[model samples]
Target: MIVAPGACRRLKPPYPYGSISISFGETLFNIRTDNFILGLTFLAPLAILFLNILLVFKVRRILFERKMNSSKKQRKSHISLTLTTLAIMIQHLASGAKTVIGIVRPELVPYALIIRHRLIDLGMISVPWIFYISHPMFHEKTARVSSFT
Candidate 1:
């Protein structure tokens, strides 16, 4: 019976967040939270970006190596992989940029958060488009005509 596992919830956890302070003569921004969420949020995307850079470099080496024959299919595959990386990277950048802008210039956060959401959504929407076109199940299977009607 795995109905309720409140085994760890009974213990009181200590707050881990440290105050974020930015000051120009006087303090412009000073906020503190119980959880150190912002650090992870920022670092997670950064890690993805680092991985993306490595992937791109590896793909580039495969494409441009002296002895390797770079065919149309390989180029197309590389392009698709690069495009996917770019879409994901841009999405992460947009997400992180919003936070940085909010911290530096609180007045200029694009008014409504919907604008930021849309920018992020655009990147997310583009990543799947490549998959939709390339996936075999999604493509129509043409019947080979043995006898002409």
Candidate 2:
């Protein structure tokens, strides 16, 4: 289905209470809600950010233990993946905080805008790195399994 510019693709049922949409320039940033689910949506990214941190830690440990054993190509890939994970996690956390603060305080909208713009940039750059990391990890895991078999 096609969605028009500035229109949300998902249709949410309206609550008995009124809700507002937060907009910056042409884009609708978020929909304000008194409902718990909406509040959870604002907080969900924070949880993902934490997960990313955990993955980074795990990846770092692997890299550290294998530093001497792994080839230059593998080590470089690990470094790039870890750094990208870290940067994305930071960007997600900051953006989530900005969104929560914006909704709760409404006065921090400007700060939220700055955070949103930064996230947009981070998303553009980090998505490719995520795939980069995943592709190698997938192949490595497959190779290990095949050797075991």
Candidate 3:
């Protein structure tokens, strides 16, 4: 899950620099040096995305079914959660596509690498926003504090 540099490199002489080193479980996949492993790395995220889509659809259906009987705040929370989930799923797919493209198409690696960190930052920032909007308590506290001001 943790993709960091200098984690592990199995190349005979090791990669020169700026290589994609992904650590999953006990194995380290060095994409720049290993073509076969690079191609295989694509499967993990694709599989995850497939599973996520199915789960998201099921969750959305359940949320919608209970929407009619839920209070306004509950409805808002459900909507926020659904939207956040979809946004995250899309982010995951985009990241996976970028990784695959970077590995398969060497020419595009420069471009893909440039946006990688930005995408990660976006994902990190969105997590708190999702929690804030989806939690009723946060909204209530904000509303109360705003009323005092």
When sorted by TM-score, best at the front, the candidate numbers are 1, 3, 2
Error of 3 at 111 (Å): 0.6
- RMSD values, in order shown: 12.0, 12.0, 8.0
**Worst lDDT window (10 residues) for model 3?**
6-15
Candidate 2: which stretches are off by over 4 Å?
1-34, 126-149
lDDT of 3 by residue, 56-80 (tens): 7876787789888878787777667
Lowest summed-lDDT stretch of 10 residues in model 1? 6-15
Per-residue accuracy of model 1 over 1-149 as CA lDDT, tens digit each: 11222222221212134423222221224433313666766677778888999998887777678336766656667766776777778777776777677677866654424466877889888889865664444565799879777
Q: Kindly report which residue pairs in candidate 3 clash with one another.
A: none
What local lDDT score does residue 52 receive in model 2, on the 0 to 100 scale?
A: 88
**Residue 74's lDDT in candidate 3:** 77
- Candidate 3 local Cα displacement, residue 82, angstroms: 1.5
| Model 2, TM vs. native | 0.55
Q: Give the per-residue Cα lDDT of candidate 3 at 127.
A: 68
lDDT of 2 at 58: 88
Candidate 3: segments with Cα more than 4 A from true spot: 1-40, 141-149
